[model samples]
Target: MITAIVVALLFAMLVIGTPVALALAVSGSLGLYMMGGTPMLMGILETTPLSTASSYELITIPMFILMAEFVVLSGVADDLFDAAAAWIGRLRGGLAMATALAGAGFGAISGSSTASAATLSSTTIPAMLRQGYEPKLATGVVAISGTLAMLIPPSIALILYGIIADVNIGDLLIGGVIPGLLVTLTIILTVAFLVWQDPARAPAGRSYTLREKLSKLRVVAPLLLLFLLVTGTIYSGIATPTEASGIGAFGALVLVALARRLSFGAVRASLLRSAEATCMILFIVLGAHIFGYFFTLTRTTNDLVALIGTLEVSRWAILAIIMVGYLILGCFMDQIAILILTVPIVLPVIQSLGFDPVWFGVLVVVTAEVGMVTPPLGLNAFVVARYTRRPLGEIFGGILPHFWAHLIVIALIAAFPAIVTWLPSTMGR
Candidate 1:
């Protein structure tokens, strides 16, 4: 009952618009003090923030964010969209497919959903609109395709999940590649299917000659090559995830310089943005640690695991329930906030069911990706709406098809865990 009340208070704070980091800290500290006393609260505050914030592995977050910021400054997203559009510009709903593809490429480079969605919405949605595509298909594809950023390699979500779950970050990142690619292809096929069912949704895309496609490819190839070099080192056991992030950040700078777009202002902007983002994530991590410590004292996590184990239901059923819970929660909260709050709570049950942590990480991430496009508070949907000046209702409606695409890919991964695990398992780690 006390555990339930603490959890309820936390939820109430979030619902009332309290900042997540602060809510976590206040609720957690209060819970500990009430349950254990001032000594306990002080101990948690003293150790949790210090230890969680100072983890050596935590440095990877800022490095990756810096790299992504630089890549954004380099204007790689525009080139990616142009290249994908050129290569696949003739099929029914081809522009949507290109958006998905370009989103994937940008996800690889940027490792952020909002960054991918915002950039693509501003760049591709207008082009699709000018080509006479339906608004739903145009805006929906951009928003849904942005989800690939959270699933793909160098993902911020995967990095945090790995760190929190105490899994090997390299293997966790590699594990995402297949699942992410599958999600991308599934999104393309969804667009194709939607257009096939209603050709008016996307009549046709502008055709590009082979030469034009090849020429456009040059704009994005260097960044793709940079991604390959950095991630390749990680897969080949040549660099840790941290080192790879540093390499990626430097490579992003080089790519920008090569494009003659690098400037002191751009670099400075990237640094400041990355620093802000990094600080926010670190604060959230510290708070989650303090909160997680309170859960340990309450024994709520252990009790929940035991309770679940004692149930007559199958593990798979329990897993489904968990997934559904995530989907529901996704509708109401930011993915990062949801992860920080729930992962520590449910991880014990997940492991008790004998699920692979890496695969579960991918599943958790893909589920959260749905939130990025779902209604009421879908961040990506809002990004699309803001850029296209479309009604939020229409944007939400447009997102459903892409939401189904996410469901289909998630089902495939669940059925064939190897779909997410094979690549990472092959790594030397």
Candidate 2:
């Protein structure tokens, strides 16, 4: 009863538009106080914040953010889009395909959905529009493609899940590579199908000379090198994720310098933005830890898992229900908030059923991707709409095909968990 009450209170706060971190912290503290009085409350307040905030792995967040910021400042996203256009621009729906390719490449470096969406919106949308692509197709492709960052290596979502679930961060990151690529392929195929069905939606782009395409590759080499430097070290056991983050940050800075795009103002802005984002994430982590303590004290996860074990249904059925629940939640909540809030509750249940947590993590991020383009609270859709000045309806409409494509990718991973786990198994060190 008390556990239900606390959960209700948490949702009540959320429904009332309270900040997620504060909602979690407040409900958790209340639960702790009610269950154990002042002693428990004092103990939690005294220890949770310091421990959560002081996690060394936390350093990776800010460094990666800084790296992304520097890369953004250097305007590499524009170059990536141009390069993608040069290579694939002549195919049917080619410009939209280029957007997907560019988005995947940017996602590799940026690890941010909204950032990817905004950048693609600015660079790709205009070109697609000028090429006579329908507004819905142009905006929809950008919105959905932007979500690739959530599952790609150096992904912020994957890193956060690793820290929260106590999984191997590097292995978790490597695990996402194949799934991410599969998602990229699916999105591209979805674009082709859309164009095939309605040739009027997206016109073919002009062809470029092979030499011009080769030249464009040179401009993207620095980004590819940076991705290799960051991910390769982690895969080869040469650096931990934290160390790679620092290396990535430095590499991005060097790239900016070589491109002659570095400025004092850019550096300051990057630091400020990175610091702000880090603080926000850490605070959410702190809140999640507090709520987690309260939830554990109540034995809710164990009780739920025990209850689940007695059910007559197959594990797969229960898994389907859970996935559906997440899809619904995605429509209403922020993905990171969903991660910190639900992972603690759902992971033990998943493990009890013999599901791999790493595979489940990839599924969670993919569901988040679905949420980003879905209606009501599709954050990526909103970002695309905001940046491209497109009607929200068109943005949502455009994403419908890709949204189904996301569902298909999720089903593929669910059926063949090896798609997510195999790469990680082969990683060095």
Candidate 3:
């Protein structure tokens, strides 16, 4: 009865066009009231939001987001993409491939999929279109590849998952490294394969001189340094993810100043955008906390855990089911909201089945990354389509290959947990 009310209220609020955070809060409150009456509901309402927001680990989110904004405003994305294109654009479908690689590079520091998609789309789509790249392919690649932001280190989703699930943030961050690179490489290979199969779909070549390539290297140097400085610090235990984020944001500001791109107007705009995003994320998180508390009060997670234990299926099969559920949920909900809502229920079940939390977090992140490129409700796809002005259908179609690539990687990681665990284990994190 509690579950039904929670689901109904959540869907109803969404249908009526409430903001996601407010909807989560309303639905959670409804569930709490139904299960424990007004006292429980009032307690949750008074305390949950503050508790959720005060988490020290979550501080990484705004810092990473601010770093991305500064990088974009500083014109760093433009330089990175330009350098990427110069090196790869000569090959068939090279620009598209380059966009994926560059998106991965930019994602390392940004850690926000929407921001990466918006920045990359604004910079690369026009250039690719001018170069005679297919609209669907160009926009699709950018949209899908931008999701790397969530899978790479410094990711906001990973941080949230770590905090909620009590997994090591460093482990979750390192766990993503190999899988993220594999996905990027898979996208590149997919583009190469498609172009090879139908050469006409992508124009041939424009080789650059050695000097030209070297000249462009300077353009992407700041991005590389920033990535290494932030991720390297985390890997070396020199700083916590939150501290690394602060360092990254500071580095980005310095880069902007060095490039003479910093201005009072730009600084104001970046802060405003970061604050808006941070508030939206925090509200959803707070609502999820209330909802999670409500679930606990009703013993929903406990009941669900018991129900899963009684199932005859193997744990691997159950894991597959959970991944599929995330894939479906990812379609309708934003990544952070999905994590906040589901992890409380799912993590207990996963641990009961003997799976590692860090590995599971990576799996969840990869699946959610796919949701970013999946149709109709994919925020990244929408951002790309809006920016490129391409028919939404084309962008959706273009993402199919990359989507398959991500699924393949997810399967591989599932089959061989070492892929996700090796780095974190090696670091003793």
Best by lDDT: 2
Per-residue lDDT over 1-429 for candidate 1, one digit per residue giving the tens place of the 0 to 100 score: 767778898989999999898899888888898898998888778778778877988888888888888887788788888888888878888888999999999888878889889899988998888888999888888999888889887899989988888988898888889888888888888898999999999867778888998899787768778788667888999999989998888898888898788888888888999999999999888888888888988998898999998999988899899999999999989999888889888888999999998899999999999988887789999988888899988888888878877887777888789988889778865
Question: Which is the leading candidate under TM-score?
Answer: 2
Candidate 3 off by > 4 Å: none
TM-score, structure 3 vs. true: 0.97
Query: Candidates sorted by TM-score, descending order?
Result: 2, 1, 3
User: Which clashing pairs does model 1 show?
Assistant: none
Stretches of model 2 off by over 4 angstroms after superposition: none
**Which residue pairs come into collision in candidate 3?**
none
Q: Once superposed on the true structure, which residue ranges of model 1 sit more than 4 Å away at CA?
A: none
Clash numbers, per candidate: 0, 0, 0
Better of 1 and 2 by TM-score: 2
lDDT of 3 by residue, 91-160 (tens): 8999888898888988887888998999999998888888788787788889988999999987888988
Clashes counted in candidate 2 amount to 0
**Whole-model lDDT per candidate:** 0.87, 0.91, 0.87
lDDT value, residue 228 of candidate 1: 81
Scanning candidate 2 in windows of ten residues, the lowest lDDT window is 106-115
